[model samples]
Structures are given as structure tokens and as C-alpha cells.
Target: MEHPALIIVDVQNDFCPGGALAVPEGDQIIPIVRAWAEDFFRQGYPIVTTQDNHPPHHISFGERGGPWPPHCVQGTLGFALHPALQLPPHAVCLKGEDPDQDAYSGFEGLVEGPEGHREPLASFLHRASVDTVYVAGLATDYCVKATVLDALKAGFRTIVLRDAVRGVDVNAGDSARALEEMAGQGAEIR
Candidate 1:
């Protein structure tokens, strides 16, 4: 039997509606994600949540000439997970805390440690014997898309819960295009 994991990507305050980089109606998906996470927890599957815990001077900030405004800065309220997201006690939180990298994918960033470990999402999933991954959360066009693609590349069966995701949609069709791209890469769009 194939085990599955739920990967909630970047459901931080900064991505919700009214935060710095608010995805329109991004907060709306909280209840849906929370319910799914709760069910997954009850089923004894692993639930992993990723957060954009960048530095104040992170390269992805517009102040540093990057595309986005300062968001999810380390130690800031914007860096915290949304108040409504009900993360389980055992839920693994992966933080993207590099100041120089724009970590759009949960699997692309390094976790802070003495050695600044490079443990990615796949490492956690594999450790839990997870073969299928169901992903949901904020900014469908960026982090969610990147995470899905990486999950597929890492040989997990990837599924995107469309209703549980919102997008920044920097461009008019970026969100739609991102979904298409993920599907093309073998992610099942539910």
C-alpha cells in the first residue's frame, strides 16, 4: 500500500489576504486545508508545512531589487503561519531561512542549523515512507507549483488540491499556466 503525505506550502501570514504579499482570498483556503490536514493526521499520515522564513534583507524582497515586497521576514508576524491553519503537533515545519536565495519550492531551501542542513521536503516524506503527496496552500503559481513539480521529480505521486490553493497571479494567466505546467509534469490536479 502506498502511503501519502500532506504538504502545506507557505501558508504564512504574508501570503494570506491582508498580509504583505497577500494572495487574493488566500485566507479562504485555511478551513479546507485545515480539514484535510486533520483527516490526514487521523489516518496516521505525515503532514508537512513549509514557511518562507526569510531575513529582513532577503534577496527576494523588492528592497533588494527582487520582484516581491518584503514578506515573511524572520521573526516577524508575517513570517508566522496563519492563525487559522491548524497544524498538528507532529507536523514538520520546514523553514526557508536563506537571505540570498528565493526559495519558491519547499524542497529547494536549506533549513537553518549548525551546518545549515540541506534537508528538503523529499527527505521528510521519504523518512515517513510517503509515496504519494497531496499539496495545498497559498500562492498556487509559485511555491505550490514549485513544490508539486519537485515532488514529482523526487518520484512521489503528486496531487494538487485546486480548491485549497490561491495564487499571486503576478501576470494575468500565471496561475492557470502554472497549473498546466504542473499537470504536464505529472501532477494530478484535483
Candidate 2:
């Protein structure tokens, strides 16, 4: 049977309030995400969490001339998932670890492996026979937007939990615009 997967994207400390690259009220969604994950877990569905685990000199850091401040550096406290999120050890955690790649979508992340091969998020879902994906997490305008679009591109039925996401909102209305774009591309905005 085809199951629905939960893609919780970038709910790390660095993205939350009082961190390196804090999104306004980013921590507010943790409780909701945790509750949703628990429900999925109870139903025996796959839960995939994405983390922006960049290196100290990652290209996405403004200190390295990127657009944003340094955040989610690997091995740092900021890179860890928020303490309040009680995820099971079996839950898949995909990390974007490339120093030069800006992996906004969880599906686009290049996780380090023994043979240096990258594991795409879609492959995991396909392996588990997942045909639908429910996404929620920090920064709706960026990571959430990218993940939802990629999910649609991968032929999965995608749904974005609007109340369970926050955005960087660099342009004041970026979050709203991103939701519109996602809706336009066949993603349900719940």
C-alpha cells in the first residue's frame, strides 16, 4: 500500500528564535511538528526530517559572501534539532553537508556517505512506497517552499501545513508569495 510521508524540514536550533539566522517565531512550530510527527509515527508512516548541517565555511553563510548569516554549522549546538522535538531514532534525518551547495529543498540535499554518493529524498520515499507527502517546518518561504515544489515534481501528492510553518520573510511578504506559488503548482495549502 502507498503511504504518506512526513517531511519535516529544517527545524533546527539555528533556524529558531535567538539563534544564528533566526526566523521570526520559527520555534513556534516545533510543538505542532512534533505532534504531527507523532501521529505519523503511530500510523507507521515514514518520517523524514531535513537538517541544514553545513560546514563552518559553507557558501551559504554571509561571512563567506553568501546571502545569510552563518547558521547550522555541523557539530555545533545550532545545527542540532530543537531539544523539544522528540523524534524517534529510526526517523530518517537527511543533512545538507556540502560546503558549497545551498540545498534549499530536502530532496536536493547531498548527504555524505561511505562512497560519497548522494541520497536524494525522493529515493527514500519511493523505497518506502510513499505516494503522498505532508510538509511542515521552519522558514516556509525558502526550505518549505523548495521541498513542496520538489515533492510535486517527484509526482507525489503534496500538502503544506500552513499553520505549522514560519518564514524568514526577507521581503516582508515572501511567505505569502511562496504559498501562492506552491498552490499554483498543485500543492495543497492547508
Candidate 3:
């Protein structure tokens, strides 16, 4: 039987409030995520998580010629999950490993083509018989948006927990616009 999985995206320390690349009130999602994860587990639905495991000098960081601050360096404390979320020890899928690839979407890595291909998250979700995916975590306008869109494109029913997301909102309009766009793409918001 097909089971719905909770695809919790980047809930790393660096994206939490008070971290290197803090999203406003990012820590606020911890309790909600924990509760949802627990509820899903108790309901017997499998949980799969994605972590932004970037290299120390990853190109997404401003220090590495990107627009954002240096954050989520591979294996660093900042790269670990937010402490309060209490992530299950074994549910994580580490992505963004290649420094040259800037993975805004957990669906696929930044690098593609013959030499540096990474696993397609959509295919994994499909293989797992996932009919619906509940996404929650980190910046709404970037990774979360990308993942939701890709999930839809992959034909999975997608839902975004509005209260559990925090957006970087670099231009002040990102949160609202991202939500509108995702909804326009057929994702249910709850």
C-alpha cells in the first residue's frame, strides 16, 4: 500500500533563529515539526527528512561568491538539525554534498549532467509509493518552494503547513509571493 511520508526539509541550525543565516522566527517551527513528525510516526507513515549538507566553501555562501552568508558547512555544528526539533535519529537524507552545487530544492541537487548527478528525490518518493507529501521546514521561498513544485511535477499530492514555515523574505515579499505561487501550482496550504 502507498503510504504518505512527511518530507521535512532543511531544519538545520544555520537556518534557525540565532544561527548564521537565521530566518525570522525560524526556531518557532520546532515544536510544530516535532509534533507532526510524532503524529506521522504514530500513524505508521514513514518520515523522510532532507538536510542541506553543504561543503565549507559551498557556492551558495556569500564567502564563496554566492549571495547568502556562509552557512550549513558540511559536518559543522551549524549544519546539524535544530536542537528543539528533536529530529528522529535515522530519517534524514543528506543533500547538497557537492560544493559546486547550490541545492535550493531538495528534489534535485544543483549539479546535473553526466559527471555530477545526484539522486532525484521525486523518484524516491514515487518508489516509496507516496501519494501525498507533507512538507515543513526552513525558508519558504527557496528550498521549500522548489521542493513543493517538484513534488507536484512528480505527481505527488502536496501540502504545505503554513504555520510551520519561516521564510527568509529577503525582499520583504518573498513569504506571501511564495505561498501564492505554490498554491497556484496546486499545493494545499494548511
> Lowest summed-lDDT stretch of 10 residues in model 2?
110-119
| Candidate 2 lDDT over residue span 1-190, tens digit each | 6479998989989899889989999989988898898889898888888898888888987878999888888889999889898786435455557787788898886433355565677776787899999999978999999999999999999999988999999998999999999999999999
Task: For each candidate in turn, give its C-alpha RMSD to the true structure in angstroms.
Answer: 2.3, 2.2, 4.0
- In model 1, what is the error at residue 55, expressed in angstroms? 0.7
Q: What is the TM-score of each candidate against the true structure?
A: 0.93, 0.92, 0.90
Q: For model 3, state the Cα shift of residue 92 in Å.
A: 1.5
The collision pairs in model 3 are none
Reference-based lDDT, residue 147, model 3? 87
Residue ranges of candidate 2 with Cα displaced over 4 Å: 110-118
TM-score leaderboard ranking: 1, 2, 3
The residue ranges of model 3 lying beyond 4 angstroms of the native Cα positions read 109-119
Model 1 alpha-carbon miss at residue 35, Å = 0.7
